[model samples]
Target: MSGGRAEGPRNIAIVGPYLSGKTSLLESILFATGAVDRKGGVNQGNTVGDGSAEAREKQMSVEVNAATTVYLGDEFTFLDCPGSIEFIQEAANALVGVDAAVLVCEADPAKATALQPWLKLLDELDLPRFIFVNKVDRASGDVQTVTEALQAVSQKPLILRQLPIVKDEIITGYVDLVQGRTYVYRESGPSELIEAEGDVADALGEARFAMLEQLADFDDHLMEELLEDIEPEKAEIFRDLTDNMQAGNIVSVLIGAAERESGVRRLLKALRHEVPGHGTAAARAGVDPASKETVAQVLKTYHTQHGGKLSLVRLWSGSIAEGDVLNGDRVGSLGQLMGQQFNKLDRATAGQVATLGRMEGIVTGDVLTGGGEAPELRRAPRFAPVFALALNVENRNDEVKLSGALAKLMEEDPSLSVEQNESTRQMLLWGQGDQHLKVAVARLKSKYGVSVETEKPKVPYKEAIRKGVTQHARHKKQSGGHGQFGDVTVEIKPLPRGSGFQFGDSITGGVVPKQYIPAVEAGVREYLSHGPLGFEVVDLAVTLTDGKYHAVDSSEQAFKTAGRMAMAEGLPQCDPVLLEPILQVQVMVPNEHTASVNNLISGRRGQILGFDAREGWPGWDRVSAYLPQAEVGDLIVELRSLTQGVGTFTFEFDRLQEVTGRAAEQAMANAAA
Candidate 1:
């Protein structure tokens, strides 16, 4: 590891959409800072931040990876977050503890548009951001065109820090606008300042003037000097840009080919010179559980194979040390994380990330402050499970072990949820997408030595009446000592949708007597809970008009039998209908793929509620639709495949729609079988 004097670390997270080369950029930064001997590539599966097995296998980051590097004698701790939306919450959590963000973007116009949400998030966080236009070496588009496309999606003023010089589609080097100097990369791997002449000088001068103009907006003196044609000092320009950035008034855009390490060194140098570190320790106000004192936030929790549990924490105020007991809002064990492992640190100071080991009763979003007060931390990102699957242990005897393994998996990824439907008796695992669940199951086997089978989860369906019917049922039995006799006349009527089930006793006094009335209602409820169609019965009412009971053998059992028999006989006569659940879904995809998504939704018997272009998203739109739950089982898989893994959606249970014709017959047949 590289060593440097710690003077208030500047924690910055690198974030963007997937395949925008975020991990590659991080690797280049690590190499440029001399923290690593050589840069690692994603394809080679040797990058530091993309170290997880799942990430390596998928050639994409699956979690947040942190490391520290020194640039220009300043220490900077960087977090490289996964780009897939399935793991986007990881990036959002990292955002909580960071001071700023470096938003990486691809040169493609469409890819640049996909970064709008990330840019908007940074804007909302009010953190100064720098746009790194990566993959310049392989870009076929013009730099100016890409910049314009980016500007369309960004609300902040985008100030160009560097201008690329192209020769036959090759980015030879970049001209530093702030320094008014041009550097071309030589075979030796270091940039060399080259003298410009003629048209080249004019073009460079024009670009320099544009950058100077942007900086001048932050300083009246510079603006006046520019109007007077008086030259401004290079140091003054740098100061203005840095000040504007810190104030969140300007966002600097830099161009580079991170894979080739072309302008990576310059980018790092700029970060060190421009980005400011934390100023002072102050008590960050947070809700206190024990008392009313303020507290700090817990940003990350890691479960390592060798390191145990580590809670990467950021102290907002006061002081914390080893053995200093702290309580979390939610009950859990607390521990500090260290480099894929955790150790109990004796103590940690404010504004520092420390690993606390084996801490009981702690969680990721818990606060620890003075006076034994612990408050709930900020809300974590919540993405509804858009896809689900029923899972069963391959070996029947391993059921409990499989459940335990899944619990561990859930602990690692809070986005995942597991539940067993009582009516269907299906063990379901829900996640953001197919890949998300696939990875979860893989982890279950690899980490816990548990194996399981997965299939499309069954939709929780119901059977309801469309019309009313009246029927009579009787039960009579005679045994040696006693005789059983019961009879009932009941009217079953269809209730309005969502009214649920209701039972009423309208019988006259002394008819069946009030004693056995409760028994009849209970029986009706039991049968409704599992409807005549073999599913739960809903949206109906049953009323008891009259009944008879034998004086010697009348009992609750006899009445229950008569009630159930009456319901069984009257339900089939009332025109039962199978109701399937529908889900309201919002799908986000590239504009080019929007039509395809609409067609796919229609094919699934979905109704499009319409679509609108998303704000600040240049080439994307959000499509609103309602689809049958059954059709959405693998919708995410098909969507990702269609959009090259750039599409995502969120959905929730909407309402029940009646299945009709052949579909209803098939469902009923399957239920009966």
Candidate 2:
């Protein structure tokens, strides 16, 4: 707690596409820092990053993992986030607490398309990032071509800091362009320094000059020095690199093989020199670093099998202790998380990632101030759900416990949502994709003791009558004490679509008394609830024309009974039809996949309205269509496959349309089943 900032912890997030070796990179970094004696493999299910049982079973990360280590006497906390498109919410939330990020990916240029969304997000947030070209040992082409491909997707200019040294078509080492030195990758021990004055001297000069030109864009003095045929000093070049990186003007590109720990030391060395201090990151996140108050924000949350709830937070200012009050709740324990393990700390300082135990009401993305209350945290609009499932408890006894479990799940991932559809009488859990729901189900069983099942939600179909019919019915009964008799004639007619239900009285000379009219309408409404087609009736009108009632025996109950009988006899005489819900969908995808998206809509029996370029999204199109509710259950899966997990849509219930022919019969049969 001081006015001046120190070179403290560097909070960096490891993020990339699925199967791009992000977890491998985290393991390599941890091992290089002497945090672990041995590196674990993903196939062996022994890695500290993906420690969850579900993740180990699937061989992928489903949530965020945090690990802390010390390098060069500065604390470094690296967050290993999920790489799957389905679990992107974890990365989006994790980025909020990180001071910087390492964008890991394969060396294949074609896979560069997958990095577009992630780069776009980082640029939008103005977060400094570095590109780690993983799997360079098996890269397909030269480094220049791959770097050019990657530059197409990034908003900031990419400065390549190293080049692969190939011999016999095998990458054996890398040349550091800035330091002008060569380091060979050896599996036995540390990388050995090789002389750059051999056959590689010419190639090294060209590469280093190109890297310097990138830095010269921000430094006029360097440009003048270059034009005057004078080489700039090493200190001047380092200043330009550090200044541009801290200002988010350029991205530093490095190469490494995380699986073999190749080039890992060079990556760490570059980070120690360039990564900014806590004050710079706090300003980037819109927090005033000079404020003499306790300010922290929760980035990710989890529930352990025995440790209760853990709120993973990044301290922006001041310090927090075990009993410190935050967001109106006292921190039960002060702990530091290393993967799945926690070590209690007496107190945590600014710029450190700490786990606050048993935060009863705190959720992900919360910012606590000195008042022990959460203040408003502004953020971008959240992504909408692209798939949903209707949830059911395996044992009905768990029905009462499901809500609490779901609330905790939502607290962990705000992108997930739940809504009880009253019209369909279903509890639907909405998420990004099928895998998201699968992980949720696993969490429910493991953490909350609630077993659940999921399936496609039922469509809320309605029925309406066509034409008109008039019928007369009488309810006559004789009891031991009294007699009951009531007669009524009613007319049933169909109204315009969306007209709803209406009832009118047109009795002549008060054949049905005013007192009994209310009961007659009540019976008509009760029958309308379930029509001849076994669905809620809509868009119809009913009238009471003529009726005969005895003053002594005709009570409201008798008149109600007569109304019910009349409706039963009249509604059948008219033709009834089913009406299914229609949704107006707006699908967005890259323009290259527009034709495929159009085909998808037609295959699902959807009518294409039109298409145009999406506003604010370059090279993307927004296509509008009208699709049935039943056909939308699995549309997201096909759309993602067609667009490489980038296509998305927004839809709402537009109107009800008539269902005829085979579709109507199938719907009726499904309802019966």
Candidate 3:
């Protein structure tokens, strides 16, 4: 493979909603560029982007995959990103390094609505973008209708660059609007420019004029010529379109059936002429790292089969070679990524993407320059692990292997985390959703051969007293010569919420000696750790009102025993109640599904706080509410079910709410049983 720099080495990310053929489009682009002999279908699980076992089984892109291809003498690096909302962070990360985006949209208007969030993200980032109407042959709607629907969501004016020629439900070819050329796909892989004829010519002329009118917005001379009824020069029209595209004023829309290889050649040619190359990328990204300072952004990290770990980085400036020192350390090895495969290289130049092999302490989103200067280039996307599972080694003897496997899994996906809960004695793994955790477990077994069983994680509930009570406990056990004797009266009171546990010595001179007071408090704290309801006790006060101790045989042990007994007797009598942690949740959903989302929240025992219309997202509302932590396990599934998988929420720990009556009783009964 040659590493020769092309005219414009542009990095573009293909992003859209779930099942919108983002991966398929990349596969088609790779095949069309002759990088792959045969295209891999997503259903068959053989696509390049979905190379992981979990992705193969699910037939979805779980992370970002960067692949480079030479299209029309221009080296194009395409980042194929997952379309599922759970993996939107992957897309966000890919967008940070890329200069532009190719927002793939399906022909269905309903399906196109799912791309609005992605479009909004692109607009916020101020990145240039184009629209690719994929799966045109299979779509029921016409190209013009789909284009109009897409234009409504796009912040920039979307101009059609290619018009599809349909005949009896089959698209033969596309008319190139810029050059006024009609290309018809031959039987094999190539397309030949044919002479325009009849209705095709008329349709082509109308589409070409519409494109020229949009292109004229960026060129004053062209606009004046168009207004004066003079045809603008072809070079001027193309120049205006390219300039406006770079300025993020206009988005070019192209129609093609990626699977059938229709209009792909024209699309590639358009990308070559319009997309920004390496020089443009470096200029827009700012100063070159080698000349002034070193700057390279880590786009992604991958764990290979034999090559170990590779951190794929985009060099914004400065040349990185093997043994070149950076950040007070020598660069280990420079390599290039071919899907999951890594190829060792001598060095990678500025304005190029290269795999930095065996980077000891580097992580995703890290910017490593020269002279011990390392800054974080981009903010990591918000990926909270909401779902959790209690994991245990199946063999019980592979505990070390299980720990190692969990660590490796975390290294691969920062979103998945594992922790050991000391009190519960359960190893827990948390992720974005059930599927996310399940995939992590699968990777553990497949990659490390560590078999583990998982179960629903336990909720950390608490117990609190509702009233004050006075209780007495006595420990008077006589065993042979030494007799154990101790007595205490504890004034147990309910503290205000969040007051926690309080201990005070109400005893006067030598009643319960100062030395033994510590013992009594320790015993009370031990009992408080595990309440009568089998949960931690919180927000209460325990004061030692009065007590008696034997001077001869009564020790701190005896007094501690008596204190534990007093707490056991007093807690149940003070109207003990169970408290579950509540999470304040804010769900963002489409306006049409607001009622359904509200009802779903109510059904989950959520307390509605307020609702407001989202600023940029039209026909969307953000519903803020509070729900119990226990009710949040499957909330994402339910919200997706209610809103056609277009809804998302963020939640945080709120104040604890008491669970009383039947709910408290049932919880206690279950814990006891």
Top-scoring candidate (TM-score): 2
**Position 536, candidate 1: lDDT:** 90
Cα lDDT tens digits, model 2, 44-109, are 998889998889988999999999998878799999999888888888888877888899989999
Please provide TM-scores, in order, for all candidate models, with all chains considered together.
0.88, 0.93, 0.93
Candidate 2 Cα misplacement greater than 4 A, ranges: 1-6, 197-199, 372-374, 471-488, 507-518, 548-564
Supply candidate 3's per-residue lDDT for 522.
Answer: 85
RMSD of 3: 3.3
- Whole-model lDDT values for every prediction: 0.76, 0.86, 0.79
Q: Give the clash total for candidate 3.
A: 3
Query: Which residue pairs in candidate 3 have backbone atoms (N, alpha carbon, C) closer than 3 angstroms, thus clashing?
Result: 289-293, 289-317, 290-318
RMSD of each: 4.5, 2.8, 3.3
Candidate 3 displacement at residue 611 in angstroms: 1.1
TM-score-wise, the better of 2 and 3 is 2
* Model 3: worst 10 consecutive residues (lDDT sum): 1-10
